[model samples]
Target: MTAIGIYGSAGRMGRAIATIVETEGADVAGGVDAGGDPTALAHDADVLVDFSTPAALESHLAAAVAARTPIVIGTTGLNATHHALIDRAAGSVAVLQTGNTSLGVTLLSILVREAAQRLGPEWDIEIVEMHHRHKVDAPSGTALLLGESAAQGRGTTLGEERVDSRAGLVGARTEGTIGFASLRGGSVVGDHMVVFAGEGERIELGHRGEDRTIFARGAVKAAMWLADKPAGRYGMTEVLGL
Candidate 1:
């Protein structure tokens, strides 16, 4: 039985992960929130699943490293420093990080890449995503990841050429530009669409997450897969073998 520890147990995603683990016949060793000692919780488990905030990610990664626990991180909105920490931890323990954990989303990314590669610069790429009203981040990590996929397909870097949310007086969409838009409302689980628009036609690759449990289930699967790996960094693409 895999002993799983959950960080940010009080949050929506964390609780969902715990429930999924239980339903999947895994052991819920323990969990930690802002009010608890995450290091101690991780120390007693074989693997840790983190669905916390960007601010809390560093401490969670540090705790996992200290305990020599393999971790599956599903948090988004991470900065460069956070990535550095994850990379350092991967030197000591397996670390699986993903912007989106839905298996369908991973497949969508793969298709988006293929579309971007085949469509050429004449077909402009745009990513649009929507989440619940409570979400804090804009554009979303998923949107950015999708943009990165498109950029990779175009043999470019997302950071070097991202055009996020055109505002008033924006003349026109630039050629070879990747754009992003975000929407938040109601209790939307998640929705993402990548549009490839040309002169007279449009192609859309999309994924709708009707249930949050899909993400939780994917995270659990990733944890199980990471448990047997040597110290290294991985992603959902690796998990899904895409």
Candidate 2:
């Protein structure tokens, strides 16, 4: 069996992945947390799953590339710099990164894209997402992923027409622009809804993550699928065949 490693082993996500990995009869080479050596852990495992912090992303990717070990990145709050790093690392090792790893969210993205395509520009796209109170980032990564899907379906790039927030008597919603709203409170694992509002009606597509276990399961599955793949970047859609 493939040996798996966890980068944020002491955290909730790391523990969850480890628990499920054991239950699935898989081998855990080791895990790394704050102050731990990721390069050492990467060297010992066949694959790595990172639920660690953005500050550690560079070191983690370097370690993965050096060890030639594939990695699944489930960390959120990443920026362009982080993505640039992932893109570079993918040249040396297989790297699968996603905002949300749940299979349902993967399919939800596909459906959101299709809906955006089928509907005309008359339909205004708005995405709302909510996460746990402890969550740091606004407009969770999954929300952006769905926004990307919506943009792709409309044959436009998200950066071209994406609005992250609204305040102070904002003007009317721009046509063809994707709007995002974020809510953080309680212990909501995750919840997302894509609303397509037209003149006479509206269509809403959504997904609710009741627990972190779903993300952990998907990360493990993605890690397994990535273990033997060639050097490149990947997503949950490839893992779930969505």
Candidate 3:
């Protein structure tokens, strides 16, 4: 059985993943939380699954590389520096990272990409997302993931096309640029919708996360799938063979 070690073991996602791990017939090798020893945990398991905070990402990657263990990162709110670290770690160990791990969301990203590709540049794209009030990031990572997909279909990068906020005198929606809106509320898991608007027609694609366990289950699935893969950086799309 695959032995999966978890980072941020004290958090909700860490606990959820542990339950799913056992249900899936895998061994819960161990876990490490804040100030915990990740290098030792990595050495003890076949793979590492991180639902930890962005602040913990660097040490976790170091530990995973040090132990030559594959790792699945479900941590959100990561910036360019964090991704740079992940890219470096991927050179030495199999590393899979994603904004959202729910299989439904993974497939939704694919559909959004296809829709963007099929539609014309006249079709303006907008992404809207909502999460629990306690969640910190605006334009959640999943929103950005969907934006990236749409941009890919349009033959552009999200960096160039993404417009995450708008204020007074923001002007008309740019022809091909992707827009984002973020909402926060009580006890919400996650919700994302992508709208493609044109002159008279509209297409919207979305995924609603009803529970956190879906993410945990997917993370476990990804960790197991990544355990034996060769060193590389990967995404949920690769995990699902999409």
Worst ten in a row by lDDT for model 1: 33-42
lDDT of 1: 0.89
Off by more than 4 A, model 3: none
Task: Put the candidates in lDDT order, highest first.
Answer: 2, 3, 1
Residue lDDT tens for model 3, 47-155: 9999889999999999999999999999999999999999999999999999999999999999999999999689999999999999988889899999999999889
Q: How does residue 223 of candidate 1 score in lDDT? A: 88
Question: Residues 80-124, candidate 1, lDDT per residue (tens digit)?
Answer: 899999999999999999898888888888888888988898898
Task: Kindly list the per-residue Cα lDDT of model 2 for residues 139-242, writing each as its tens digit.
Answer: 89899999999999999999998998798988888799999999989999999999999999999999999989999988888898999999999999999876
lDDT of residue 33 for candidate 3: 96
Candidate 3 has a TM-score of 0.98
Clashes of each: 0, 0, 0
Record all residue pairs in model 3 with backbone atoms less than 3 Å apart, i.e. clashing.
Answer: none
The residue ranges of model 1 lying beyond 4 angstroms of the native Cα positions read: none
